[model samples]
Target: MMEEILYLGNIIFFIFLWRIILQVLLSVIQIFLKKDRSSTGDEYHRLYEESIEWMRQESRKSHRR
Candidate 1:
């Protein structure tokens, strides 16, 4: 029947729409996670640099003595 065909077509259309929406949401989540990871990486890098500087100062003090 024509009504059944129309109902099936609508269902297919909705499925396609939902797929697109889900993809977009996943992309947004990925971007957010990447940003968070980068920020954490920067913090870790800063800590490493500070540790290196501290070690260098300790070495210099030992050499002076």
Candidate 2:
């Protein structure tokens, strides 16, 4: 029983170590392949402007009613 427990502990340790290594590798890859910020930024700016225009139209509609 004790031997089995030790073997299980070793297996768990290896799995944990592997996960940490994999995470580090993926983070490094991500640093090199990150998306362009300017395009996303432009999309957000366009959405914001559209939202503001929609709100203004809604306000005008309410005033006319």
Number of the top candidate by TM-score?
Answer: 1
**Looking at candidate 2, what is the lDDT of residue 58?**
100
Cα misplacement distance, residue 53 of candidate 1 (Å):
0.7
Instruction: Give model 2's clash tally.
Output: 0
Give TM-scores for every candidate, taking all chains together and pairing residue i with residue i.
0.87, 0.50
Cα lDDT tens digits for candidate 1, 1-65: 99999999999999999999999999999999999999999999999999999999999999999
Model 1 clash tally, residue pairs: 0
RMSD of every candidate to native, in Å, equals: 1.1, 7.3
Taking the tens digit of each residue's C-alpha lDDT, what string does model 2 give over 1-65?
Answer: 99999999999999999999999999987776555566677899999999999999999999999
> What's model 1's lDDT at 4?
100
- lDDT for 44 (candidate 2): 95
